[model samples]
Target chain A: MTALIAGAASTTFGKHDDLSARELFRDAAEAAIGLVSLTAVDIDAVYVGNFMGALTDDQGHMGALMADYLGIPDVPTATVESACASSGTAVSRAVDAIDAGQADVVLVGGVEMMYATGIAVITDALANAADNEYENEAGLTFPGIYALMAREYMNTYDVSEEDLAQVAVKNRRNGVSNPISQFQEEVTIEEVLEARPIAPPLGLFDCCPITDGASALIVVSPEFAANHGLSPDVRIAGRGQAGDTLALQDREDMGRTRAAERAAERAYTAAGIVPEDIDVCEVHDCFTIAELLAVESLGLCERGEGATLTTTGETAKEGRIPVNTSGGLIAKGHPVGATGVAQLVEIVKQLEGRHPNQVPDSAIGVTHNVGGSGASAVVHVLEVAG
Target chain B: MTASWYESFAAAVDREEPQYRRCAACGESGLPPRQTCPTCGEPEMIDAPLSMSATVVAATEIHVTTPKFEGEAPYTVVIAEFDENVRLTGQLSGNEDVRPGDGVTVGVERREDWPPVITFTPS
Candidate 1:
């Protein structure tokens, strides 16, 4: 009853200034549909994930719009939004529907048109994900929020900024190998430490860019995949979604993303596997420190040992765990809504042995995506199907 | 039920007083008061008092900000605590170098057209 991902693709995940959100989605959707033998008319359900379209692109009602662009306007479709986890939730819903015998040959797409409106407007739109009444009113931005988390963590863990900068150093290194990555050049730890400051203890290198892009996945039931003689590998093994307080202040522990921990626990349980079995991961590295927190939250390592992975180069593509091999959100560019689906796309590329930064012999992969300030989270486990 | 929570709290700040939502049953306290206890899910909570004396639990200086704080880059934000473990997230008015465990006092600006702006001034 598992939902198998037959085809996946993404438009280059950097600035797509010439493209509209729906246009970008169409490009990705068409590319994804082109990969499989099925046509757009074969898709029975469509779920599109989008955020800030109303503000950035002056567009709304993305689900129907995307379907219409794909020439399948009659399908049942809806837009899903859970902040940055929007597409993650969309894919989650698609998996459930196929698992429940509701439908087969579902199309899931995630897109964000951010570069159109410029940074100030985009920043404000991004803030819509936080608690407006409190966090936003207090002039706290996402960088500030994550910086606060990093500060507390550093204070308690006795970790230094150099240790933190290594995350950017590692991910940017991997970014150079990823064709869709926003940053193609490698950065030294010193350069990262000396980079322009976005928030104290977090240099500009530490944050993900405001990207404009879209990604897509064609998910079908196992029966449909088998019937069509589709690619036999890459099935959605497990998925879990969880939420926490919208405001960061309400959390008992500011340094820990409880939502990610819970979501990963559920995902791992559903997959019948442990963190150690994960051959690779595409985590929500919206920030450098985020990757550290993400690995810990995924239980890929112990609480404070993420720094070890970064410093020892274990999370690099050629290393043990090969985290963020697709350059992650930090380098791959986080088009908010598109991020979660794109993460899965990267995992599929890795599991299929064709990623730009392929990890050798990678069979099991995980995608961890979290919304603003660790409020909402979704985790998915994908593996080479038997 | 907590519709007037922000206004009441802002008004109290204007009167040189501040209050926070406290769950008497669970002894849990929080800010931007919720309709129910964040911890115990209780129906009602008391507007417990918040003191000027608070300690910084976490602090971050934002080198870039959103449009609301345009031309106000390089600002500090902190999570500070009052008595009863009540916490508030706000801007740091001064002492940009302050870090965790620093001494600070809450400062709130009440407004009619906008939400109250809260800050923590290093003590």
Candidate 2:
């Protein structure tokens, strides 16, 4: 039993001062269900991915609330939380329910509203993802954590700041074509280098902006899609999730994300596909340096060469192996929980040839979502169903 | 609320000598006390004074910090490994130049309103 995506939609990833996380989720879910031409009666269950709703919105039991808001209060509901990979984790669960014949169709998505609060609150909330006692207590935030990795990577690979700035420049360029992207303007290498340092060796442009958005995916078993006379254009080819030590100091290597490596390997084996088989990919570019590490950890490039790839334009939208054509979290805005589901939406659009910046002949795609400094990771492979 | 692992480190730091925990059964040495040995299912652990000097394996200068760390922005944080397996994180005493593999000495530092924290300085 394979799960196929029937429909996908996402709200623009940016500040939504007027909407709460629930309202954003509602908008995305309604639009997504509309895409499939489904009613509340069609959804059997709802899985909501949320990272900090409790802290930010003071809301929990989101599963029931979301289902109720969708006018399907009786449906079984569960809220998945894995920090940044919350929605990605939710997608995996939805796929499991359908694959095991437990459900025919499921509404799986992620939502986060961070603009209601200030950066101070959001930073503290995000810090909960790291080791509260060891890492966060040491006054390290996400930017500082990734900055550590960037520094080590630079020293190990003999890479320079300009090499990393290329990633920021490339993703921003891709974001220009994405109407839903938070930052549609492109940046230059010099500008990135000159940007105010958020964490030394990592400037303002190196980090993903705080965002508020929601994304939803309607997944159904192949039979369900067929019974409804709907074409299953995209199929879940492979899925994998892995975990690692929460604290970077506990890990032996900070240069690589072990969880991503493990997840990508499992996903590739399950899909019977290699890196070369992937035509397009949307990786977790939560940080510019993260983009570099993600490519290497996914085996899309060699270790210590991720920066080189960025510098040579290999990971650009027009490069040899296009990555993050949706502008990624860098320019796409990371709503944390919604990022995973949003990644899949971009991949599906590319495969359907409906993406604004289409990767020519993109048939196979991969999405990598990481939670909290690579402590957890989920990898999914998607392909055109023909 | 003080975490179990922080007890030994915090206590030692207050005494002006930093310490790390070693699982008595498996001989795994690190900081931030664990109730049980991660490598071996042993609950017995011992605290020992860590080597005053260590090597910085990773370092970063955080320009923006969390609310708890307000006014401490632009501080340098480093992960230093001591006695081969014992690794810990601390803020450098000053905006000193620190690099991977740079030798440093660990100690304790107290800020006006914050709790005692581990501090590292170039050895």
Candidate 3:
């Protein structure tokens, strides 16, 4: 509760052959530190959010690596990984340190370089987030995991493929304006439907691409901000993180995301704001069905009403509540560890009224980030501090 | 890995018997065995054998496969809610057109150098 976001920055989400993982973090880290006019020495600790560095990037011990790379090698540091929610959890940890009176300023950054791993190798690596002995061994993939939910969703509800395709249409339209987004060009629902199937009900267009990007945020104690004569309008109002069963077969209702619902409930109570109070939002749309599940879990709409909400154009930027204004993970790019921090970046931008696709008079925003198959979900509510 | 919990389930998979854990305390059934009952944290769970009959709950024909499944591309995966009230996710055996609510029989394909693959046949 005492943490205030001093600075935020991110590398463009997509292919990056020029920079290593540590280098990517450096760029974002230096920029974020510079945003509030501080050197690395001012940061009391470093929290790095990274996943799959050892398997794909041949780099492990990310905390020490990123800290040493940023010329702050001696600070206490740790690498946090909850699959894709790594950075989101990392940010939460930094805030906790501030609330616990451990540190004045903490540097949190998330980075992943997956584009170099290629499809075959990366596909298997990403599935490590699932239950490897059962789910992966049984041929279940990340897309397949989401596809299973999509199937149950369709069979139980009066939904069709066309209904899910609307998510891509709206997000792709939003991506066209986000320079950091991976897929800038828009695609029609016809293109979404006609696209080759990855898993039934989810096509190549429905899934998030393998991305290489990084995001960084400088979190400070209220006293530190005052001592430095820096007043931040954006503060983390409330945050909630929860877990669910790792595999899909274990879930009682495949249609619902229990972790997100629980996490959002805790966050809403913490922030003292309801879903209706949210002006702009960003969610982990790892798959099109994921966005629907997220909105329902976050209470944006009723259960089983996400697809209908999209069909009504209420989730679009110009609609009642602008969701995924940063193109979401579907279009913005999901660099696993960086996604949570990246979602926070988008939310902060909207709260600052400086977003590339800014909404009118937006003072409150929320970010929903979930790891593989809803096993890990973290929701944070950011508000403009007076 | 206290894999003793999984040994019975693995043995059942190897023998192709339909078995799942039932909490001795609460009678809740679970698959992909765990050390304790997920519902009540009961340590005494018995592996109740089943008749292998099941119904299709959901199915997806996967075109994009992982590195392991890449060699065996384009296979249908099914979540079958067995008659015993436990669900198993596996590949559809022989694929004779299955939709939700269709009756099916559970099977396991075990081979050397590969993990056990759960399969379902429409009945």
Candidate 4:
């Protein structure tokens, strides 16, 4: 009863000046549908993952918009919004329907059109993801929120800024081979350390850019995959979502993310695998420090030991556990709503052995997407068809 | 359910003593007060003066900010622990050189046409 991902596609992630969110979604949806043998008429359900479309585009009803744009208006469609985890939640919902015997073929898409507005507007829109009553009103920005975490992480672990900069360097290195990535050049740790400061201990390079793009996945039940001759190898083996206090100050420990741990625990339980079994991962690296937190939360490494992974080159593509081989949100770009689905697209590529920087024989992969300063999280485990 | 819980802190700050709500039942206290204690769901929460002394558990100098605080970039944000283990976030006053474990005192800075923002001055 597992939902199998048969096809996945993503648009070139960057500032798409000419395209709207629905247009970007349509492009990605068309490409995804083109990958499989199915057509728009065959999709039984459609879910769109989008964040701040109303603020950015003055549009709502994303699911209906996508349905009409795809010429499948008759299909049941709805949009899910959980900040950056929007599309990730949509994928989980699609899986739930399939698992409940509600649908066979389902289409999940995530899109964000951020460049339609200026940085100020985009920043305000993004801040809506946080607790507007306290955090935002207190003048805490997203960078500021994560900056506090980075400061605590550095102080608690006795790690230096240079240690975290290595994460940016590594992800940017991986981005060089990814044609669709926003930033396609390798960077040195020195450059990252010396970059202009966005938040103390976090340079401009330490943060992901404001990007506009879309990604898509075609999920089918095992029976449908087997009967249609679609590639059923990449199965959605596990899925989990966890919630936490909205405001960062309310958390018992700012240095660690309980939501990620909870979500990862549920995902691992469902997948019947441990962190050691994961060959590749596309984590929510909206900031460089997040990558460290994600690995530690997922039990891939011990707490406070995350900063050392990049220094030792273990998280690199050729290293022990290849992380963010798709350049992650750092280099690949983060279009908020589109990020979660993009993570899955990358994992599917890796598991299928067709990733741009393929991990040798990558059979198991994980995708971790965080929403609004770890207030919410969604984790998914995918396995290569045996 | 007030227009903003921050106004409570703002009003207290106008009197030169910042206050935070504490639940008698759960011993939980925080800023931007809630109707009931989030920890134990106790409705018997009362306003108590925040500790005059606190220590910074974390600090960061934000070099970038949102549009609302555009010109205020490169300011420091700190998470300080007050009495009763109540932790709150605020901007550090005097643009002081602060770090984790630094001692500070809570204060308020009023902004025209807006609720006063909270701050922590190095004690």
lDDT of 1 at A335: 95
Off by over 4 Å in 3: B1-10, B14-16
Kindly report which residue stretches of model 4 are placed more than 4 angstroms away from their true locations once superposed. Answer: B30-32, B40-46
CAPRI-style quality class for the chain A–B interface of candidate 2: medium
What is the Cα-based lDDT of residue B34 in candidate 1? 72
Among all windows of 10 consecutive residues in model 1 chain A, the one with the lowest summed lDDT is A224-233
Looking at model 3, residue A294 earns an lDDT score of 92
Question: Which segments of candidate 1 are over 4 A away from where they belong?
Answer: B1-4, B110-113
Q: Which candidate is the best by lDDT?
A: 2
lDDT for model 1, please: 0.86
DockQ of 1: 0.81
Error of 1 at B21 (Å): 1.7
lDDT of 2 by residue, A346-384 (tens): 999999999988999999999999999999999999999
True contacts kept of each: 0.90, 0.70, 0.73, 0.66
* lDDT by residue (tens digit), candidate 4, A1-386: 37899879999999899988889999999999998987899999999999999999999899999989999999989999999999999999999889988889999989999886987798889899998766776678888789888877777787888888889999999999998899999889889988998877788899998999999999999888788777666999898899988889888788888899999999999999999999999999888899999999989899999988878999999999999999999999999988999999999999888888999999999999999999999999999876
Higher-lDDT candidate of 2 and 3 = 2
* TM-scores for all predictions: 0.97, 0.96, 0.97, 0.96
Q: Against the true structure, what is model 4's DockQ? A: 0.66
Which ten-residue region of model 1 chain B has the weakest summed lDDT? B1-10
Q: Itemize residue pairs with steric clashes in candidate 3.
A: none
Off by over 4 Å in 2: B23-26, B35-48, B111-113
